[model samples]
Target chain A: MTQIVRTPHEGPRAASAKRPGRSAVSRRSVTLITGCVLSGMILLLALVSLFWTPYAPDDTSGGRLTGPGAGHLLGTDKLGRDLFTQLMTGSRIAVEAGLGSVLIAAVAGVTLGVLAAFAQGWLDDTLSAFLDILIAFPTLLLAMLIVAARSATLGSAVLAIGLAQSAVVARVVRILVKRVLAQDYITAARTSGTSWPRIVAGHVLPNIWPTLVVNLALQFGLAVLAEAGLSYLGLGAPPPNASWGRMLQEAQATFTTAPAGALAPGVLLVLLVIGVNLVADGLRDTLDPATGRRRS
Target chain B: MTLLDIRGLTIRTTDGHTLVDDLSLTIAGGERRGLIGESGSGKSLTTLAVLGLLPDGMTATGSIELAGTQIVGAREKHLTRVRGTDAAIVFQEPLTALDPLMRVGRQIAEPLARRRGLKGAELQRAVARALEQVRLPEPDRIARAFPHEISGGQRQRVALAMALACEPKLLIADEPTTALDVSVQADMLDLIDTLVRERDMAVLFVSHDLAVVARVTDRVLVMKDGRAVEEGDVREIVRRPREEYTAALVASARRLESALDTRRAR
Candidate 1:
């Protein structure tokens, strides 16, 4: 009678093959669909903007403060730059920043976490202590420091956000890897002559990825917001790159004359974040190993 | 022809509390030896030590020579090389012993692919055969299903199949039927008996129950409080136990047996 306090999600919790059907299932799908539609809208715009915006984002091709018209579908800003094009391009950047930072975090964090989990006494202690200290440091401030060190550009903002968020990812990964290592199957795998790398690849990674994917998805929204915040502080990719945060900041002065200037980018940013969060929630429902929905 | 030989095997916690005292065991090629002890008597730890898989912070001293490989103080690299091909284990709880996330077929295919270099169509056939050997009906569906999707009996069968995939020299079953129902337990024992006999493999069957051990093994080693109390032929130990601890174990087993017999007769 070894005291193996297995994680609740594992074990005989859902031993029966009862189909999970309820209001909760239907509701999650609803949110999932809505999130997809919202997030898809931004992704579609970003893709389309790659080839075509209403006008060049830097073009002063319309009258200042002009209302939405056939010529400029959204309008023009104080600098007479096409607002529609700016917002479209801004989305591309938003998506880029979100995706970039998330990718970075997933890669760096999972690596550090796996290493720390496998590390022996002194190494494990050192890695864990370092991660804890990083966790205490604010992600945005770390990003800002990276921005300050390098020239204020898109690459630096992305690198900063990604590197800063990796610590959180790594810490979570360490706990997850350790939990997996404690399972009886892990011992079984070892006894079966599964090499360390094979066990990690087969047992460790497969057991952990469902939770990791969802975690990375949620971090996507935060990365988006963090990128925008950087842009607002004039620390994002330079103008014409016109990240939505920069749009919001520039629109701050012209709220009375043309509320759409601030309103458009602000609205898109909120919608995007909401969409990503909802999608993350939807993913959690979908990818949950407990519900046994992720088997295939 | 000795497949497993242990001398002065001792396990201690990092804090210096001894869990398993000086114990010795020897299993010849194709021999079946039963290690009987109640929980905390170090039966399971002995099995783990045989596989060189002692838990972290706990230390094992003294010699454990399995297939001529020294287990005590051996590096993980060398130990891993001896594992599976030399000896494989089926844990007490099949539900947790299995990777719940993996399909049954793939899990069985692991040792086969690793040890025998099976792949693709050949590997699939081997997996199905392993499932079939375990007497799992609908090997196709069961193979595709997850551990939780199958019944507890089927999961244990799958675990046995995985252990036997490469047909190792020895099989260590640590309370293999402890978590199983009585009828299923009988069937699993019968299955293990038939399969191991077919393969001519040695078995280290660890259990707390005398009746369970007697069913599958010829020899039994009675352990109490981390020390070997008595060791003899299974029937001899059960029929006329030597030590007080062993007598208690036999008495309890007899009580359970007659309890069942009376209920059946009545």
Candidate 2:
């Protein structure tokens, strides 16, 4: 019954007040800028692909499989379509798969984690057993099996990737949730007559969010790699539709004839993953109280 | 009339180990009582039982009445209401008792908002008054401060401020001054004692220190091996303890004081 009337800036204000003399913007600017720029580029690519492409990515008359030339920049693929347009459009699928898988993993993992910690006894044991079983299977193998069973649609492919990735998320989340539950603030919230839902939402969720966010960023990078692997193996987005993974598969066939075909998508994939990892590593270092000052 | 009445209370864990047994105690309106026992002697368990805060797997076959309402097997929602209104507990370690993440002002405001439905400026004013009651300097600044930024004594005072914010009929202080230095402990005890006297609030001061119990309580209950072996006036418990356990506790207390006296004399 104790209604906690939140002051608008209570959390941020207290954090800032505690560390006076430092600007909030300066505290996390580098990691924030890198994460934001990469994420923004990924988003822009996805949105732009929905409306238009520079050229018809599947058109034959555009080049008839020619190399890099005027108008047909970055050459053409086996289907005589522009590789640059195809790759640009292909960015959407990679981003979607990565983002989609993360969303699924986050929701499933966090819910299971919080529930397991809060609901002890049978519920906890049951969830723990299930997560253990799920984590034992390799993510790629599981996704492959799922795609084979479900007939390989984009939605099913993402679902497969998500299910594969969620095991790791669940494991990490369980540890963090367990730690958060044991914190004195949680005990204080309980003693204050805060309801169970409020305790989970207000007290539990906010405190565990930093770790979860860092995990999500790290997981997204892995999911992108995983999705790309699946697509290359012919279990990703269906043919005629653009996918970074599918593009990589096509590039492999034409590796000697036009190295850009394989190299462009392959290099982009590596850079994106590295960027994500760098940002994730930076976040992990920044958010951790023990090492945060060292970073500063 | 008694605000809290515990008669023949016994609490046990799932393993059938007795944590508190056959313990009878009472706190009438405006009375201050002390429950003195060393660690693991069940004084803290008795207090938690009164608040209905024993963790799951722990069983209590005891009558814990708060303001005439039995809370031993009360529903959680019912117990929740009882906590902020009828009775509240102040933990020994205030830094841990209050959430480190929350602002001190908001922590104090929780009970008032819960029991009295205070909001906005009224909530702020109530928090300010509670801080003042605990005699915290720069109440406004302290309100904005996180738990870590404050000293141990200040944190305990904040915990006291939180416990008193609801204006409960009875306050259960579980070694509230133990974590503080001797001088700060004295100041904290004085603050709690003065507040209880002024507001006519019954207090259950749980501690291991006999002298501290003697200073603040009218009656003392000495517990050992999860049982209340002796119960009487504070001075009588200190001077003429009947039970061997109580006598041993007093003896140890005297030994510590004489040791300190010897050190100070040099």
Candidate 3:
């Protein structure tokens, strides 16, 4: 019944109240803001693609393998589909797969990690061993296993990547939870009649969230990459569901004729990954003011 | 009258290592006793056993009767009820004992609201009163501030205030002042003394320093390794040494005090 109101991230006023003159703080904010812009651009592109993409995602009216010109913005793919339109469509899939897989990882990993934190002796050992084994399995191999077991589709591919990556998230959460539990404040809370659930929500969750968030953000970028790899291997979402990886796979054949097709998606993919990583690093600074001084 | 009674308590680690051996002690209502020992001497474990809050992979086998409730081997549901009502503990490191994320007022308000059923506005007033009781200046501001925002001494005061908010019959202080600045140690000890006397509450003060034990406790139990080496009246133990271990502890405390005194004599 007790509600614990916590600001997930501090507002601008609080951030400013800190020593804003510090170069380190400014640098992190710059990185964070830039990452936001990059991610926001893709998000906007995807949303716009939803309503209008200049041409249908599969439109092949334009001649095949055309270079950038007045009519074709970024040129045209082998199928004569508008390359810009396909890239726009690819952005939506990237965001969806990134978000969907991260959601799966966060929910599954946090639960398992917290449970392991609370577990003792045999249960704890078994869970830790299992998590390690899962983490050792490559994302592609896991995706292949899932695809073999079920039908290959976008959902299944995201599931495979998420399930594979969840072990990493769980491992991080377990360590964070254990550290939080060791703090004397946890004992103090217990002695003051706080229940376990309340302690987990109020103490354990809030204390470990900054690290957890950073881990999840990193996991997001990896999920996108894994999905792209899966798509390239012909295991991801089928046709009509154009992916940056699929686009890159198609472009490899006609690289000499139209390098834009390959360069466009490849650069965008790398940019998205780097942008997410920058945000994760920046978030490590911004969300954790208490540890900021020590880290900086 | 025997509010806190521990009989033949033994703590064993998972690998069959004994931490505390056959420890027996009792405190009547309003009586204060000190459990003195160096690090890893099992004094802290003894205190933890009183609340059934021992670490995982460690087991306590003995009777811990606190406010008429059996603590050892008690179910968590029952232990939860006894804790904060029968006894509350203030750990050594006060700065880390209070939640870094929570405002001090809300930290104190939890027990007040839970045990006393105090509502919103009323809970706020009680939190302010608790802070004032700790003699913290500008109670409102201190209540509003986070643990790191205040000094170590202030955080200890807040911790003491939280423990007292539940009005438990017994207060277990495990080296409470050890982590404070030297100047604030006296203030913290005095605060505990005054608050306990005002409530007529029993206290189990655990510390390694003989002088600290002498300052607040009526009786003292000297522990070495995992066994109780000596136990007697604080004045008697300090004046007439019965065991070599207790004598060494006394000699060290005397040396420390005289070193300070001789320097001041100049």
Question: First chain of model 1: TM-score?
Answer: 0.89
Q: After superposition, how far is residue A198 of candidate 1 from its true place, in Å?
A: 0.7
lDDT of each structure? 0.88, 0.79, 0.88
Weakest lDDT window of 10 consecutive positions for candidate 1 chain A:
A1-10
- lDDT, candidate 3, equals 0.88
- For every candidate, what is the interface RMSD in angstroms? 9.3, 9.9, 10.8
Superposed by TM-score, candidate 2 places the C-alpha of residue B186 at a distance from the truth, in angstroms, of 1.8
Q: Higher-DockQ candidate among 2 and 3? A: 3
Q: What would the per-residue lDDT of candidate 2 be over residues A212-262, giving only the tens digit for each residue?
A: 878888888888888888888888888777788888887787788888888
True contacts kept of each: 0.55, 0.27, 0.45
Top model number, TM-score: 1
The candidate 3 chain A region of ten consecutive residues with least summed lDDT is A1-10
Clashing pairs in 3: none
Question: Residue B46 in model 2: shift from native, Å?
Answer: 1.5
lDDT of 1 by residue, B148-197 (tens): 77778888989999888878999999999998876678778888988988
lDDT by residue (B1-266, candidate 2, tens digit) is 98888988999889889888898988899999999988999988888888788867888886888897898889988877777668878888876787655688877786678678899999899899988778777899989977777778888888888777778899988998888877677777777888888899999999999988887889998888888888999888788989988999899989999999999999
True contacts kept of 2: 0.27
Residue A178 miss distance in model 2 (angstroms): 3.1
Task: Please state the error at residue A14 of candidate 3 in Å.
Answer: 16
**Residue B219 alpha-carbon offset, candidate 2, angstroms:** 1.3
